[model samples]
Target chain A: AQTVTQSQPEMSVQEAETVTLSCTYDTSESNYYLFWYKQPPSRQMILVIRQEAYKQQNATENRFSVNFQKAAKSFSLKISDSQLGDTAMYFCAFSASGTYKYIFGTGTRLKVLA
Target chain B: DTAVSQTPKYLVTQMGNDKSIKCEQNLGHDTMYWYKQDSKKFLKIMFSYNNKELIINETVPNRFSPKSPDKAHLNLHINSLELGDSAVYFCASSPRGGANVLTFGAGSRLTVL
Candidate 1:
């Protein structure tokens, strides 16, 4: 079975700074995808970024980017120039190619301080 | 327009009661899913449907049932709700094929007293 792990249970960063959330996964499948999702107090799960296992270059979306290390099976999220709006519970997810199951890691509660 | 919408946004019922959560997606995606988020924020997949066909059914209790009239809609009905059933239910959808990128609804919070 594929499993996703997020070690940081809580994190905080000052506004305009940068923060990184760690994620690791255990999977034997070579074809897979990774995603980072943000859930605010409104309880709306929003897509942040995604990365493909075949692509070595990490995926970047505006201020959010992923540090995907496929060989090491590590996919971490880096939030640059963090803003107050970035305060939320961030989740790291994994889905094997052609599979409907999306395994999610325990979320990291991030707080952007002023 | 909202890509994926679910209602009622909040449901509160007593023990042994029955409840249902309706979900619909306007994104024209062929796959829909039901996920449960516990109080600790752990999210788990309950059921999944592709083109109105049951695809993935997790180890959820038999008290929970899911229905899909079409590819665009998936509804979950729970019988004999228990205190442990109190959690936030999320409806999500993805495109027709193997790409599992998902768009989720604003969750329906269920409280079983």
Candidate 2:
């Protein structure tokens, strides 16, 4: 069994600033995948970024990046130049390399203040 | 075009009634999954199908049945729905059975009265 934890229930960031959302997981599997998903007001789950446990280097998208510490079992998401559109509920998920099930965290509601 | 789509964007039904939600993906993925997001917004996997075969069945009650006619389609049917069953259901698909990223649908909101 695997579990993902997002300690923060809610977070706020000023416009144009940067914000980091923390996440931790417990998994006995050596090979796995970590993901961050964003659900906006439209309720569409969008993939933010992903990291492979085998990859020591972090994963970075245009404005989203992940700080993955495999040894610590930590995977955090960082959003840069946050805009109002970035306000949404973020979730951290984990899946074994060859599994179809994704274990998701409770989620953190983010608000971007102007 | 929508990569993954679920029909009946919203469903309102009475207790003990039976309902079904349809999901389809155009990505030609071999694996599809059904997840339930409760009122508190906690998403949990209920069932998973690979190439129309059941792969993962969580601790969910047997009342909730999943049917996959093909690799690209997976539908969820719930019998004797209860108030606790009111939640948002999401359908997602991944390219393969490996570490491929999942693409989720807009979600179906089911309200059991």
Candidate 3:
């Protein structure tokens, strides 16, 4: 069974600083995709970033980026210049090719302190 | 316009009662999915439908049935709901072949008393 793991249960960072949330997965399939989602107090799930296993280059979206290490089965998300609006619960998800099902990890509560 | 929409965002019902939640996506996507988020924030895939065809049905209980009348809509009907059924259910959709990126709707929170 493919599983995504987020070791940190809670984390906080000061505004304007950078924070990295760690994620690791165990999967036998070589072809897969990884994602990071954010859920705020409004209870809406928002896609922050995505990474493909075949691509060696990490994925970046504005202030959000991912350090995807396929060999180590790790995909960590980094939020640069964090703001109070960036505070939310972060989730790591994994989806293997041909399997439409997405396995999600227990979320990490992230708080940005001003 | 909302890309994806779900009705009855908040539902509170007694145990043993039956309820239904409806979802519709206007993204012209061919695939739709249902996910359940527990109190601990663990998401579990419950079902998947592609163009009104049932493709993936996880180990959900028989009391839960998903119906896709068209490619754009998927509805979940639960019979004899239990206390454990209290959670937020999300409806999501993605384009065919680009299944990795999903557009999710505002979830429906079900509270079984």
Candidate 4:
């Protein structure tokens, strides 16, 4: 019954610049987890960052961070100082607390141009 | 050492053929999942196993079957493969009480000719 949406099909950013990929989800659960995963050319899905709905503070992992607006039901990823290696397909995912299932959004193909 | 590994990284076969993709996780987690990434880059959960017990089974075709012999192994078997079955299948695992931080394996790309 939960769904995630990534409106941007593709995105591009120049090296050393910043780009933000938008994501929105619909869930009735009050406690949940949100994640951002990156799949490189090798097709290995790597966890980028994660945020808990109960945590008011957003999550940050080095150059990658999330702007989680719980009330707005929006979780966007911002990649700062982007590098060519950051080019990959990024996915937004949601999982309810105490559940093993995850609902993923349609990926956003990101290209970090040098 | 690979945390999660799936065999047959690339499987190309003719339609109506049967194939199996093996998955093993060394993380000792209680939960494992099979996700399908279609050509449109959409990832959907197909099945999940917790300690060799079926947990989540999506509305996938009956041709797709999943077997979990143990907590660390989950294998997927597809019968009468169709052209639409051509997609990347990913195996992932995560700790039961954790935040659902999935550690995924290198996907197995299935191409049906």
Candidate 5:
């Protein structure tokens, strides 16, 4: 069984600043994928970024990027130049390749203050 | 167009009642999943279906049933709803054979009284 952990329950960052939400996972599977998702008050969850465990280079999507340290079992999401729209519940998820289940962390509530 | 859609965005019901939430995905993905997000925002997988075949059924109660009529549709039915059943239910789909990128629907918030 794989477990994802998000140590921070809540986080706040000033507008236009950067914020990093930490995530760690315990998985015995060697082939897996990590993801970050954002759910706003509207309740629509959207994918932020994803990183493949086999890829040493972290994944970056516009302002959202991931610092994936496979050896350390850490995959943190970094939001650069955060905006008000970035305020949402961020979840870190893990899925083993060829498996149908996704293990999610107890999301972090992020607030972007203006 | 919505990639993944679930009906009854908000469901309010009484205890001991039975309710069902329908989900459909237009992404033509091979796998669909049901997840429950509790009040504390902890998300956990409840069930998964691949091409209408039951794959992953987590440690959910027997009162919660999932039906997949096809590869693109998965419906969740709950019997004897309880206060603990009040939570946000999310439906997601992914191309199972490819990169496991899941696209989720706008969750269905179920409130039991």
Candidate 6:
């Protein structure tokens, strides 16, 4: 079974600053995908960024980027120029190349102070 | 247009009662899923359907039943709800069977008193 782990239970960042949320996973499958999702107080799950295991280059979306180390099985999300609206519960998820199930991490609550 | 939508954004029901959460997706996607977010904020997959076919059924209890009327709608029904069943349920959709990016709906908060 594949499991995603988010070490940081909580994180805080000032407005316009940068913060990184650490994530690691245990999986034997080589073909898979990783994703970072944010859930605000509204409780809507939003996709922040995603990385494919086969791709050596990391994935970046606007102010969000992921440092994906396949060998280390680590996928970290970095949020730059953080804003108050960025405060949310962030989760790391994993899914095999042809699997319909997605395993999610425990989640990290991020607070962006103004 | 809303890609994925769930009805009764907030559900408050008594214990042992039966309740249902409805979900629909207009993205014309072939796959849909249900996930539960516990009070501790741990998200876990409960069920997945592809074109009205059951694909993945996690370790969820038998009291929880998922019904897919069509390719675009997947509904979750809970029989004899318990306090432990209180959590936020999210419905999501993907274009294909697997490994595709998911589009999630604003969750339905279910509280079993």
Write the residue-wise lDDT of candidate 2 on A15-93 in tens digits. 9999999999998999999999999999999999988899999999999999999989999999999999999999999
Candidate 3 lDDT, tens digit per residue, B26-84? 99999899999999999999999989999899999999999999999999999999999
Q: After superposition, how far is residue A69 of candidate 2 from its true place, in Å?
A: 1.1
Against the hidden reference, what TM-scores do the models get? 0.99, 0.98, 0.98, 0.98, 0.98, 0.98
lDDT of each: 0.95, 0.95, 0.93, 0.95, 0.93, 0.94
Instruction: Put down candidate 1 lDDT per residue, B17-105, tens digits, no spaces.
Output: 99999999999998999999999999999999999999999999999999999999999999999999999999999995345689999
The parts of candidate 6 lying over 4 Å away from their true place are none
- lDDT for A52 in candidate 5 is 88
Could you tell me how far off, in angstroms, the CA of residue A93 lies in candidate 6 after the best superposition? 0.6
- Provide backbone clash counts, one per model: 0, 0, 0, 0, 0, 0
Please say which candidate is ahead in lDDT: 3 or 6: 6
Q: Write one digit per residue (lDDT tens) for candidate 1, span A19-59.
A: 99999999999998999999999999998998989999999
lDDT of 5 by residue, B26-90 (tens): 98899999999999988888999999999888899999999999999999999999999999999
Candidate 5 has an fnat equal to 0.57
The TM-score obtained by chain A of candidate 1 when compared with the true chain A: 0.99
For candidate 4, lDDT tens digit of each residue in A9-90? 9999999999999999999999999999999998999999999999999999999999999999999999999999999999
The per-residue C-alpha lDDT of model 5 at residue B49 equals: 92
Q: lDDT of model 6 at residue A73?
A: 98
Cα error, residue A53 of model 1, in Å, equals 0.4
- Fnat, model 1, is 0.57
TM-score of 1: 0.99
What is the two-chain DockQ of model 5?
0.65
List residue ranges in candidate 3 displaced over 4 A.
Answer: B97-99
Where model 4 places Cα greater than 4 Å from the true spot, the runs are none
Q: What is the TM-score of chain B alone in each candidate?
A: 0.97, 0.97, 0.97, 0.97, 0.97, 0.97
